[model samples]
Target: MRMAQTPAAADGSSGDGALGRVPPQSIEAEACVLGSMILDAMAIDQVVQILHDDYFYRPAHQIIFRCLVQMRHESKAIDLVTIKEDLVRRDLLEKIGGQDYLVALAEGVPTSANAEYYAQIVRDKALLRQLISVGTQIVRDAYETQDEAPIVVDHAEQSIFEIAEQHIGDSVITLQDLLRHTFEMLEQHEGQLITGLASGYTQLDELTSGFQKGEMIVLAARPSMGKTSLLLNIAENMAVIDQAPVAIFSLEMSRNQLAERFLASHARFNLRQMRRGVITPETWTALQTAAGTLETAPIFIDDSASLTVIQLMARARRLKSLHDIQCVLVDYMQLMLYSGRATSRQEQITEISRGIKALAHDLEIPVIVAAQLNRGPADRPTHTPRMSDLRESGSIEQDADVVMLLHNEDYYHLGEEGYQPRGVTDLIVAKQRNGPTGSVPLVFLKDYTKFESATFGVEQPLGEPMADAPF
Candidate 1:
């Protein structure tokens, strides 16, 4: 013979009944959580961090648990007597069925050892409830608003992202755990050739350790200083050589234009010749080989001209989910728009920089962003860029983990006697949070619009002169 089921139990509804249908509640799990907390005072330390009062399915349980948390927060004991007194002082004792129900709760659990298990069940149900709430709000907004479809979609994405972040519990790690993980990584890297991703440039990789994860690296330079070319070089190296997935957000150039530059760089041919359809047989053969190589490369490009930071984050998240992109490169920072309304350009840039940094941290990947330096570098005697020369310097310099400025001596010392540093460029590491700051010498191939590692021999001019160079 079986006992009859209560109305609430049969319908899986809470006391409030406001949810209408079952809204993903776990009453038994909630009772176990409370029982564990009351049974063992020390169990509150763990359960308190995992759950809050609102997670309870019943209003009475919510009231009781709220009292328990308040008592614990004030360094009070968490036993039955102390919790009852705390509830009484707050006038919630009778509301929660008084001392009798509290005693029943403690007696309901077999032991407090399974507290974490019960808490997990409660958390999962809470997450499902939050999802339902977010879905309901999205539906409401869709029906009530006459806004653009993309704007509504962005709102929905932002809401879901917030809920996802909230559900990412227990992110904190102890120092001992970090140290152990670091030691294991070092042990694995002991006899390995390279630890981080290879930049394909020996000296630059030596300096940067190949753009570590969760780092925001800012590559800034004046116009025609080969910033875009250097970014493309790194992208090609990572995608084609290492077979890593790479995403490039080109705010300035078209996808086909970027492809043309890549072919010229890869085949060591003149970009102008390819653009003008004046290729020789050898050049055509090399072009065909470069095209084949690129066709198999793991690279993705988005050439949206007026992209906002919010849109960029949404797209990057999608790419990360769909393709597992290992690295991301934004063509330039100044072209990115701030999603929020700003009173000045500086404010907009600050918001954009902060948002990019947040995106890098959230995705746990390296984000390389190109920026333009102010004219202050040109006015200086040496024409070397400083951290202050970064346009909208305040936020960018503060948020970037590493700031690299590109300088071409050939661009500044044009037509000077004995000034033959043609195709020579300096990658000034002006700011590095975890490493030394210095210059990494590189060679800029003028004709192909590419950058390569500087070799140790007598420097020879390659390809066409700077007069006909297209940036």
Candidate 2:
């Protein structure tokens, strides 16, 4: 067996004391990982996902590992003889201490079972070294004084986030592993319960099996089609009925306005009458009860008027960390500002769409975003919106796991014959990545600014005020 070379001390000192060092590393862990891979040919399969060539502290180990990985990729045997022959073919065998070192590595490991554990140690130390590099760059940027503080800070945060993501390690799952997880999920969901977070609407829940985690749902509609109202209704259902913590980013409405709509919806009172302070005694009692219910619901609202997608992600992360929010709702994506350096409006919208999808994936939560449709529906005869009519860009439709279009037949045929289906709204599920697409009927209560199941007959509320409602 070849003799192993001892690495210099990490701290920059001779035999005496030292102060500054390069970065944190574990040479022993790197050697153990290499030794394990050399001991058992199949051990490379277990550690290959965790350790890359750069993870090795020793250059010879890095070269040896690279050769092993290439051999494995090519479906070749990974014993010391094959590895040495391949390295010799590339004139790297002598550079990496020849066949004797390979023999030494194979003989050093006690067992191949701890290969993954040793690889993890190497990976963690490599991550620390990367973090130190990022920190050093950040400090240098801080002292340069060329850029604005906020810009520097943003750059630093982004760099750190990228490092953290890299250190999250191999997320690739074999089909066998994935199937095992799927079987577990199926067994756990063997009962009558929905597999995902319940939307609280029986028909929609049945259609979607509830909104699955890491999904992006796009709800689109033209003006006055009650998309926001529908979003609020779902949020209400999830938060109040399911007791799931929800965070709402209302770019188009204020907190008070959203709260007022929620109160009106919950209390079954006319929003206009409540706003004008003309509610009856029974309405007052209902409003009091509704307020009490909503006061206890785990619903959080952020009504930032000029929120950018970056700011929204930061806020969503904070909400997730602090409140453990189960779902996120962004009211009207078109109103949100795109803080990225995209040139065109379409590019900006694309960035925003992609950002929200990434956020949902990163947080492993379902994100429901309300969007606006263009004037294509107005020109059409039936006036039903399609996925192509999504405003600004088509990326929103492409990024969404489910795309729903709200169409109010009443808006298009208000004065014609057999027109204006009172309180009836058609929620067209135009695109569903994992389910069937169809229309789910809903009742739009204009006075209360809410939506309910269409099975509830169109019965106007008692003591309806004859005034214009502001929504």
Candidate 3:
């Protein structure tokens, strides 16, 4: 039998500290494997074919490869500093370098991050083996016990209508007729039981029924695009005017800051004035009215920074059971955490996207998430954004049923342009797996950090925008 090789405890190679006593030979072997993998991992298809590892994690190799993987997308220098940081974190590498060493290390051929992908395959294989073993044992036990006829599970998959009329078979009503009848019934009971939430933005609602139930939406944009404002606007309309339960998970902003923004928007008080306790008597009356409105509204918020996706899900589920969360909006996707995952930012984001999607499906509500756009968008002469502009476009675009990018020309132009488009916000529907892709206009109330219907904030003077907050 071949003996397993384990790394010996470190003997202070670079003086980070004592290692875990991994054998020196094992460490050498790992370095060799990593070197070969680094070279072989050139073409993704070749690497996939050669590795044959359904899933795998090369903690030893990833120490070097993660940097290279990031470089494939852009020309980023992976110097000794970054390597030292990784090694320091793991106590695997020591910083014994100057610029010359950094330059030498940085010159190594770049590779891809196929490691995590392969690791997933290995995991699946391991799970398959376990499942087969368990399943085989179950079958053997069932046979020995001489169980009755196999438990009847639904060998037949059927739609709601099919199941409803199974016994009546051939003489069933056509699906179209049934659908028409159902629509008629729904129309008869309009505004009762089932209400397709409208975004309050006319064009947006025309395109999407205000982000339907159990939906996880990634509402991404570059800095200063007002993703928070849009959500606050929607939440305001929902909680105060429409009177629906809403929750806000704010990672960067404080709870008080958010409430202040709400007050600023709802009462048309200057955002700075309210934030710094500078409200005058007249504005205080508006603030009091806004306070009363907040007291009676169904808005919940959690502004804890660095919250993971799992934590968010658990909290969201609890909130749903308690307050009936009909819709969920994540301020931005990139801010979320993957918790126990040991993968690249892209993979972590993919996991988060899947989690949010699951949360929507399981909870039977719509979720909207804001995301950061890549720097590429800023370089374009045109103000329009696209799918490629998404920060980590890989699984985010793939998993999202609808992807909306928010932009304000006014924010971009800085008022230098001859014609300033006031209260103009762009809803660039870069991708819609279930619908069309295009642009829609929205209203931006910059100070209030809120977005309203295009005409909703039109009457407000520039300095006093959001004076007639819907709530």
TM-score, each model?
0.82, 0.78, 0.57
Q: Can you list the residue pairs that collide in candidate 2?
A: none
Q: For residues 1-471, what per-residue lDDT tens digits would candidate 3 score against the true structure?
A: 121222233222322211342212222332333333434435332333323222223333343444334442354444446545544565655322223332333333233344334433443433444444444455555566543322111111112212222231133479999999989967964655334565656566656646677666677788888887887777787788778888888887889888888888887677976667887788788889988988898999988788877777777777887898777777767887666444788878888888888877767787877888898668888765666677864777777777778877677677584965566787766665555455676766666666766654422112321222111
Each prediction's RMSD over C-alphas, in Å, is 6.4, 7.3, 23.7
The per-residue C-alpha lDDT of model 3 at residue 154 equals 11
- Is 2 or 3 the stronger prediction by lDDT? 2
Cα-based lDDT for every prediction: 0.81, 0.81, 0.60
Which parts of model 3 are misplaced by more than 4 Å? 1-181, 184-195, 415-423, 456-471
CA deviation > 4 Å runs, candidate 1? 1-19, 69-90, 139-155, 167-176, 191-198, 276-296, 392-394, 416-418, 457-471
lDDT of 2: 0.81
Give one digit per residue, the lDDT tens place, for model 2 in 1-471.
234543343212123311265466765677678888777778888888788888776777788788877887899977778877898899987776667767777777767889989899888887887888888889889998686554576578667766765744456779999999988888976763578888776667767788999999999999989889999999999999989999999988999999999999998899999899998888788899999999999999999999888787777877887899999999989998866667999999999999899889988899999999999999998787778889999899889998888988788876788654665787877777787666777888888988877886432221321121110
Q: Return whichever of 1 and 2 wins on TM-score.
A: 1
What stretches of model 2 exceed 4 Å from their correct place?
1-3, 7-19, 70-110, 137-159, 166-184, 187-194, 267-270, 273-297, 318-324, 340-347, 361-364, 379-381, 412-420, 456-471
| lDDT of predicted model 3 | 0.60
